[model samples]
Target: MSTESLGHNSVDARSNGLFGVYVHWPFCAAKCPYCDFNSHVHRGAFDEAHYVEAYAQELAHFAKHTQGRVVQSVFFGGGTPSLMDPRSVGGILDAIAKHWIVDPKAEITLEANPTSVEADRFRGYRAAGVNRVSLGVQSLREGPLAELGRKHTVDEAIAAVRLAQSIFPRTSFDLIYARPRQTLDEWQDELTEALWIAQGHLSLYQLTIEMGTRYYDLFRAGKLKMPDEDLSADFYEMTQEMTQKAGLPAYEISNHARPGQESRHNLIYWRYGEYVGVGPGAHGRLLINNQRHATATEKLPFEWEKRVHARGHGMVTDDVLTWEEEGDELLVMGLRLREGIDPARFAKLSGRKISDRQINELKAIGFVETLPNGFIRVTDKGWPVLDAVVADLAA
Candidate 1:
């Protein structure tokens, strides 16, 4: 089979937007203190075969609603999708092909952790039709890695990245910044190393404390000291400057990619295109019977499987969205891109145009700028306060 072509072209992306499938693998070896995602750590025996069957069944159920739509991307996200046997991954892909007309050029990605054990599966994943790998190499320093509860050493992380680059057509890694006690110079050095080793894409995120996590409890107890707002702003600005200088500009608030090497799967979400989320604790948006519906499944792994076996799918929520809600979602998601939102598209979805008064107010303050093509984008000056800008426009 021919490998999917790689290029960073927005026209092709927009023209080909279709269904993106997100399959969640919710098991992890250990849970990170800062994570609030719906992931669980199972020390007992795992049943990969059983979960594979459940995924196939749920996908078949979704196919009935999304018939005739060509699939443009498939992403395996996880507590640890890398932990699954490659054969299982292949089985899921085969099931997807059975139900949908998967575009030959569709991008297939799997999220992995940078550890030797996981690295050992790189070739297996490649054989299973995964053309892209996103590594969770959160930091390059040992102290921070230990603090973050990551099992991999910095050396192991780098080695895994090298091994992944050798096997995958596209590679990307994630880094968490604004960490406690991290100096700006230290972060600069770390980022320099990251850029030196980076391939086509990188996801740089600032650490945020979420409720119901260990970090949140520690923070509430005043044990975890994160960067202050002023310092975090400095870190954000420096990141933009470094990444832009390295020729990998910010395509979204937290993602940097070589012009066409952007993750097509993620783009579907940011662009508000339809997607089907399968497996445990996954969420999806789809056009069902001419109405946009939001869907979510049971988060517990075994429970989800039982639900699927009993009722064809494990979905617990399937609320149809109002046009006003769709417009709000469009505004919230589209503004994250550097390319910004098309007012015409927004008007089409919302039935009301964005207030000219708000646009002028934002433009006058240098928070936003209008392109020659008429799309309105948040300025570099405006990105730090993106939420406020979107809320203003949406209001």
Candidate 2:
């Protein structure tokens, strides 16, 4: 029942692997200028009790959708879930476990920034059920951190990473590369330093000027000066070289880890597997019986909380995927993995074969190759230009 393209939905078939949960705690101490994620800053008194109940209700709603499947993972994502009270994290996890069948070795992860205040809560989080931690140590140098608008310093990041390693054996951190005025040599040195300290995995992102982000505005206003494209490419090459030498391979375009240490939660998405998403702005794709369901939850906290209080639920949108839409979705998500897409899975998802016309065109352009089993994958030459290639395949 494993799928390549459309996605196979026959095994557990009904299981559709529809049992992972994601919790979004959307409050940050400060929003970075370059960030475009759904995050807001707040330090005043708010409804912690009400918020915890809302989270519980969201879990209950998903429990109804996925009645008997075992949840493989539960991820507590940003705006800094670490800022939450450890008790709140526990309450929600307890609710999920009570309401659903969680895998015995379920991987529970929390995303945190490197502030000491958050670090102090690490042990409490482990006690609460978090077995993995992904620290947001965007940069380790003082100037680079300030440029990225991070709240912590190099020493503080090191300290937080050390604390996380001490608490959770599976710890990882992210580093943003290709910044304005950043040199390849600088990144090489910095990466070398970070790699020396990384516990198991490292997420390296090439900074891009995303629309509506402060970085984009600054660049458009001629205020954000960055390295040229050539320089950025140079730095990416250096990153690959250094990371491979460190025994961490880039399993995804942006994530690298020691063998078998890849983020299983994220793999579910990139591998185009089914998962349930809860909380504000979270998304999920699930398959039940033989149908696909797309899920989304409330965005603003007030709107979400109101729904929670009124009907014991807070959701924004949920829709079924059209066959063509499912095809497009598979094409988009499948390419993120190194294994590429399986044509048979596509055939199963769409109940029809992928046309040789498009496949031939992509192959002619050196973007795709077919395995003996007819599974297709993006070639190494296609990785640097992946977005355009996905667009072509989807189109």
- The residue-by-residue lDDT of candidate 1 on 1-395, one tens digit each, is 00132222222212225679999999998999999988999888967798799999999888877777788999999889999999999999999999989999999999999889989999999999999999999999999999999999999999999999999999999999999999999999999999999989999999999999999999999999999989999999999999999999999999999999999999999888889999999999877545577899999989999999998899998887898998899988989999998998888777899999999999999999999999999999999999999999999
The true-structure Cα RMSD of candidate 2 reads 4.1
**Span of 10 residues, lowest total lDDT, candidate 1:** 1-10
Candidate 2 lDDT over residue span 244-330, tens digit each = 889997878788999878888888787677787767777888775566788777778677778877766676766778777777778
- CA deviation > 4 Å runs, candidate 1: 1-16
> What's the CA error at residue 198 for candidate 1, in Å?
0.4
Give the TM-score of each candidate: 0.95, 0.93
